[model samples]
Target: MSSVANWSCTATATIWRSLGKDETGDPLGYTEPEQILCDYEGGLSKKLASLGAEIVVKNTVWTEFALAATGDYLLIGSSTEPDPVVAGADEVRQVIRYGDTFERVADDYAILTGI
Candidate 1:
């Protein structure tokens, strides 16, 4: 048997999801702040578009969260706080589940895009 170390960073941020617009065409809101263990990182790159526009590609800020023994609260399209208490800060992005098959050992990751 092997033991894995727990995450050293803590992230506290609001999780947001679009609940569709109201009759007046205004967007509704639903969010909740939660603290969880995670790791964060960011990078940047530059690329030229076909239209001769200089496009700056900020590397996706990846946030990895260890899976609980019970495997709960993991969903794609869910956004989390990119700034973990341990270090680094970035904008919120959609969640990316990191695995091909169903397993509790793998971690859940959030892909932060520069918008």
Candidate 2:
């Protein structure tokens, strides 16, 4: 299959990557990582918004950082998050799902749906 062209990774997203489970079994995460620039959409349809999809991020299959995960939280800016785990009232999108569509056609894309 032929490789598809890269998507417009123009949006700079500041992310707090999930560091897996901690010793106390609490969710642990930090912001030593930022996702490579990708397509980030802030708005969604009413139906989608009702379904908890507050924001959408479309990233390329190839990236410099790790793929998006369920526990990861992100803010669509260049600012860093000191403690996303303890982030209080800050409006950030938490990645709920990650999917990769690969094909010979122009459908190769990695998508991260956040809420």
Candidate 3:
């Protein structure tokens, strides 16, 4: 009967709906996930800062070729630093599919389905 409970129920319903069939006969799913790039020149950190976002630098992993083309998505959290313009840290996730372009797939979720 609390907000959390309500949110959970809502989320569950949404999930079911997303998984279920729609009137248009299209399946619901997430597009391809892309890796979050961070710790590099002109990376997500700088972008977020430019956007007036205060983020805490979290885990950083070093990857090599054959899988390093895409950088890791920087996991950032709300900043505790004092800054009026800076907003809370937002979570970012990184993912790469074996095949298929995340962009094209995103443009058409009915074409591809996976979170």
Q: lDDT values of the candidates?
A: 0.38, 0.47, 0.24
Question: How far in Å is the alpha carbon of 51 misplaced in model 3?
Answer: 1.2
lDDT of 2 by residue, 1-115 (tens): 2232354555666666667778898866554746455555544423245667544433222222345555666555565547654442123333333333455343323434333
Q: What is the lDDT of residue 10 in candidate 3?
A: 26
User: Which candidate number has the best TM-score?
Assistant: 2
Candidate 3 lDDT over residue span 1-115, tens digit each: 3232223222110001123336896544322332321221113332234568654433222211122211211213322333212322222222223322332321111111111
lDDT of 1 by residue, 1-115 (tens): 0122144334332233344469997645433323444444546655565678764534333344432211122222324543221122223333456652343455556544333
Estimate the TM-score of every prediction.
Answer: 0.40, 0.49, 0.19
lDDT of prediction 3:
0.24
Instruction: Give the poorly placed runs of model 3, Cα more than 4 Å off.
Output: 1-48, 65-115
lDDT leader: 2
Residue 24, candidate 2: Cα error in Å is: 5.7
Candidate 2: C-alpha RMSD after superposition: 6.5
Number of clashes in every candidate structure? Answer: 0, 0, 3
Segments in model 1 whose C-alpha atoms lie over 4 Å from true places: 1-5, 8-14, 22-26, 45-94, 100-103
